[model samples]
Structures are given as C-alpha cells and as structure tokens.
Target: MKRAFIPPADSLIAFECAARHLSFTRAAEELHLTQGAVSKQVRQLEDRLGVELFRRVRQRIVLTDAGRLYLHDIRGALENMTAATRQVMSYAGSADVLNLAVLPTFGTRWLAPRLAGFQKRFPDAGLNLSVRLQPFDFDEEPFDGAIHHGDPVWAGAIAERLFDEEVIPVASRAFRDRHDIRDPADLVRVPRLQLATRPLAWRQWFEHVGVETDAAFQGARFEQFVMISEAAIHNMGAALIPRFFVEAELASGRLVQLFDISLDQNTAYYFVYPEGRTMRPVVKTFRQWLMEEARTARTNREAMLPR
Candidate 1:
C-alpha cells in the first residue's frame, strides 16, 4: 500500500505565512513566533521537500519559481483544511446547521420574507445564509447547497428548478409622469439602469417588445438588482427587474411598470447541491419545505393575476 504524504501542519502554516508576507520577520509577528523560529520552520519544510523555496535578496526575500508553484497548491489545500475543520466543528456543536449560499437581492427581497415559514416548519434545523453572486465549485466553498440563478449548468450538482423569472421595465411614478412613457419607444429615449449580471437585459426586453433602439446598451450598470431598483425608484432611470423582486414596490406604487410587457428569462432560479451525495436530515427537510413553499407562492400569484 502506498503511504499518504502528509506534510507537517506547523511547517506548512509557517511556510504559507512566510511566502504570503515575503518576509520572515512579518510572518513571525503575525504568527506570534520569533523570526528565527519561523525561519527554522521554513528551512525544515525546504529540507523535507529538497527544494529552496525562497531567494534572499539582501534585506528582503522572494519566492523562487518552485516556491510560487508550491504556494499556489498549498494555499488552496490550507484553505480547504480550515474550511473542513470549521464544518466539522460546527456539525459537532450543532448537527442541524445547514450552510446555504444565495444571491444578495434574492435572499433579502424574496427568500428572507418567506424564511419564517421554513423556520416554523423545521424549528429544529439551524439555517445559515451567505451571499454568493456567481456560480462556484462546490468543493471549494463551505456551503452545503446554494440558491442559484441561470442555467442548470453547474457540473457535478443536482439543480432543482425553483421558478422561472419574468422581468419587466419599471420606473418611479414620478419619472413616468415626467417622461410620459406611453409607448415602448419612449423607454428607448430614457436612461436605462442595468444590472451587471444581465448586460443585455434591456436589449432582450426591447427585442421582445418589438422596439429596436441603440439606447438598449446604454445605461448605468450596477452589480446587484437592488441597486438598479433603487436607482429606478429614485427616478435615476428605468430598470428591468424580476417581477417577484419588486412586488412590494410595485404594490405600494413606488414604481410603475413602463409597459405590461414581461420578458421570460432564459435562466431560472434553482436549489442546488452536490450530486450523488447523501443529504443531511436538515437539508432534506429544508429542500422539501422550500419546494412546497415555492409551489404555494406560484399558486397564490397565479390566483391573484388578472385571468
């Protein structure tokens, strides 16, 4: 049997710190160890690997070619180890903890309000929510599952479709009154608020509504939908936002739909997790509850819609 190669933890930590700072003294200060102690640890690591990891240049030090490569791999490994340790410890202390990642605006505007029902259903389960704007490797991130947007293209994961997104252009009632946006063509003349994730959103909306304009691509871009929505509400510009995200604002008449047109998004929101993995009891419970809640929400919305 081939023996596993496990480098000394202390030596690896010292080397990582020293490599990051590029100075033994700074690494020592940060690690609360003497400079000599840190240097000795690095030296021990180099001897074990039979490689000189650093090049001394007078008063300073820098990583050698080999050191740079080693640092890249070691840093990832260490981060994974730290995350694993935290995960294990959290599970030990609270077995019901469910680590979930979600988009910022979706979490705040939609999911958060409905989470109380989830809590009520699964009172014993502990839920942790963190913001993740884009897709990521499930192995690298500490999340057990994520609320994902876009295509179900996440490799090695099971993506359960939650709901499709219908987006529409909205502006503050004051802005609408000011611009007199009676026709979709009038929207073309106004400043548009863009979300960074959907750069071509306005163009798509315009095309769907059969309005061709150069202004489709012209707009102030924002990273989050919330920012764009705020800009619209404050009369900065008309924003294309998911209908569900701005339900409250629309209901309160803070913003008005520029047109009755709704564009069906190519991508949708999903509840995703690593494939072929045994789900924790808490996760299973949450998954079932979330699906039921989504169905209930869709039913309620359908009933309220003009039939």
Candidate 2:
C-alpha cells in the first residue's frame, strides 16, 4: 500500500512565513514565536523532506530552487484554505457569498455606481470583488464569475453580453488648441496614446475614419484605459478611449472629443461564469439583475442620442 504524505501544519506555516520574509527573525516576529523556535521548525521540516530549502550567503537567507517551487504551492494552498474558511463561515451564518472578478476601470466607473441597487435587492448576499485586468482560467480560480471586456471568448464559460463598446478619440482641450487639430487627418501630427492590449487601436480608428497615417502605430503605450485617460487629461497625447469610461472627464470638460467618429471594434463586455457549474442562488439573481440593468442602460443611451 502506498503511504500518503502530509507535512505538519505548523511546520508548513513556519516554512511559508520564513520563505516569504527570507528571515526567520521576521517570520518569528509576525508569528509571535521566538526566532530560535522558527529556525528550529524550519530545520525539522527540511530534515524530513531531505532538502536544503534555504542557503545563507553573507548572513542573508535566500531560497533554493526547491524552496521557491514549494513556496508557490504553499501560498496557493494557504489562499485556498482561507477562502474556504470564509465561505464556510458565511454559510454557517446564513449568508450568501459570491466571489467575482472584474476589470478594474469598468468596475470603478460603471458597475460600482450601480452596486447599490444590487445591495438593496439582496442585502444578505456578500459580494467579494477582485480586480482581474485580463481573462484567466475559470477552473483554476475560485471566482464564481467575472465581468470581462473585449470579447465573449473565454473558454469553459457562458458569456452574457453586457453592452457593446464604442470608442472615440479624446484629448485635453489644451492639446487640441495647441495642435490646432480641426479634422481627423490632423490627428497624425500629434502623439497618440496606445493601450498595450489593443496595439492596433489607433490604426483601426484611422482605418474606420478613412484616413491614413504612419503615426497610428506610434506613441506611449499603457496597460489600462485609466492610465490612457490620465495621459490624455494631462495633454500627453490623444487616446482612443471607450466612451463610457471617459464620460465623467468629458462631462467635466477635462477631455474633449476630437472628432464625432466612433469605432465599433466588434467587441463587447460580458458577465461570464463556468458553464457546467451549478449556479448559486445569489449568482443567479445577480446575473438576471445585471442583464436587466444592461438593457436599461442601452435604452437610455439610445434615447439620448440624436435621431
């Protein structure tokens, strides 16, 4: 019969703390144990595993290759355990918990403002929000669902369309005045801010507007729309930003729309969840409520548009 191997919880905890801090003394301080005791625990763990998990060079402790791999798994396990404990405690208290991942800027600008409605409707349901700037494996993470942008392309999940996205060129009023940019063709003369993920955004915008320029591929690149918006507001450059994300800046006159042209890149935001997983009651209710909210938003936006 094969024997199952499980390290003592205390030893694993000691090792994890030691690995994270790279100093037994710091780990001991955090764990409320003596430095010698922490060192003893780590030594015992290494002896049992028959490996040197750390090496001391010039009195500085550094992790070995094995220690680095072990630390990664231990951290993941600890996080899972913590999440499980929270979920069980919530269940025992008769509360519903929904773990959701969201795009940072979208969550802040749009969903956050509307969260009060969801809270009012289901006060007992606790919504745990985490920022996920990009798509990740649904099976690997503990997330119940995610609010995704770009496309409904996440594998192993059912994507519910939230809204279609429309992007327009925006810049600080000072930049426009300084550049004297009166037409779409004049955009090529100034620097353009780019989103790292959407590398060809400027090119696509120019193509849609039937204007050609080599500067489409030039300018500073950023990872998120928030950064791009900030750059635009500071007159760093013109940026192609999603309309909804920059509404506040536009309203406040911090940013000016350089052209009336908008680009539809055939991508939209989605609320996605694992396809085969059973939906928790809170998740189901939230999904229905979110869909209804999207519908209402679309209607209101269309109503405001000139005929």
Candidate 3:
C-alpha cells in the first residue's frame, strides 16, 4: 500500500483528541504528554494536510469549516477501526470468532435462552452479537451473519428460513373481562394497540381471522413489541403480539390470549449471510446449530398451538 497519502498515526491521534477537547492542554493531559508536545503534533498534522483544522478566536480554539467536516469523517473511521480491533481481539489461537447481528427483541427474548446449547456444542467457537432491527449489507458491516426478520430477500445474502411467528391478540385480564372480548372480531370494538413498523398489522390480523372493520387501523402506535406488550398489560388495549414474546405474561396472568387463531407474519425469521460466506467454518457451524434449534422450536410451537 502507498504511504504517501496517509497522515502520521500520532499526528492524527493528537489532532483528533485536541479537536474533541478543543484544548491542547486538556488533550495533552489525557494523552499524558506536555501541552507543547500536543500543539506541535497538531501543527505538523495541519502542515501535512494543507488545511487549517483549528482556529484561534478570542483566545479559544474552534474548528474551521473544513475541520468540522474532516472531524465528522475521522470520528467514524476511528470508531470503525476500534470496532474491527475489538472483533479481532475476540479471536483466540485457532478458535473461530463469529460476529452475528440480530434483532434486539428477538435476540433477547427468543435466541438468548437457547444460546447456552450452542456454546456447549461448539466449545472452540466464539460468538459475538450485535443488535440490528432491519436488513443490512454484510459487506459494509463486520458481521459474518445475521438473524433477520422479514421476507427472504436480502440483496446479496442467502437467507435460510428460521421460523415464522404466531401472533395472538392479548390484553390485561381486567381489560378483557371489562370489554368481554369473546371472539376474534370483538377486538375491533376495543382500542387496538399497533406497531409503528407494522402499521398494517391489525388489518392483516383481522384479514386472517376473517373480520372486517374500519377501526382496525385506529389505535395507539408503539415503536417496539415490548412497549406494546406493556401497554396491553396496563389495560391500554388489546395488542396482537407474537405468542413466544408474551409467554411469561400469559403464564403469569398479566395478559390473557383473547383468541386461539394466530396471525402468521408470512415474513418469517431467517439466518442470512453474504454470498460465499458459507465456506467459512464459524459461519457454517453456527448456521447449522441455529437451523436445528429453529426447527425444534417450530415443531414445539406447532404442537402446542390449538389445532
């Protein structure tokens, strides 16, 4: 690699730290160097870049227009480098380190509990997890694979079906009793809780249960299922929630299922990785384990639901 365009590492580090603190003295204190040393480093960086990164006005340092733009980009680059280093540090000797992204709620509620088994099966494998709510490009991110929830369409990645959801309408016991929700159609009469991401969720649920009403779209919208579940528990309204997510609530009697019929989110959960990544040992091992776990989960779910 050509080194001509690259600024000195010490210069970049010093400049970035000084830019953040806006004080050479403070930056020096943080770096455990003298203020003069920090100032000299910044001067050398400015000379190399051929642009004034900091300006002194009223005896205080501030960023120039070019400085502000460069700082923004450099911060991102530094953060990415730090993240890459951390991911590398996760690896040991010949142990495989698999970095996987997953939906926040699903990772916590569904996948977390079952992860112990994966560790047991693959003692030499390392797993690093990050939360992702939507589809992402594997090339742009450092993730080896991701657990996605949507249609099996991820541009350059191949998606392996994980499991679909079984959504049930639920509400606090008090709310259900007060409203006397006897059937699936009774949900339309009450204030229905909705998800901001899944705006048409209620309408789809109604369509699944063969119930038609104008009130389907009207409700208090929430950003996440946890919030919606809490709203339902507080007697806010009936919420259509995935059964697995509310198992504790249902079991504890905090919420009750109003109907036996479940809405299948046709867009199932999937384990996706970039093309050609299946050749990697870590990716392949985790994928097989996850697929088997998902199959077992699906089978158990199917057996329990009212037939």
Top candidate (TM-score): 3
All candidates' lDDT scores?
A: 0.89, 0.89, 0.88
lDDT of 1 by residue, 164-208 (tens): 888888999999999888999898898889888778898898898
- By lDDT, the candidates rank as 2, 1, 3
lDDT of 3 by residue, 5-70 (tens): 888878888888999999998999999999999999989989989999999888679999999898
Models, CA RMSD each:
3.5, 2.8, 2.5
| Clashing residue pairs in candidate 1 (N, C-alpha, C atoms within 3 angstroms) | none
Output the lDDT of residue 71, model 1: 98
Per candidate, the number of residue pairs that clash is: 0, 0, 0
lDDT (Cα, tens digit) per residue for candidate 2, span 145-216: 999987788889999898998899999999999999999998988999999999989999989989988778
Clashes of 2: 0
Candidate 1 vs candidate 3: which has greater TM-score? 3
TM-score of 1: 0.80
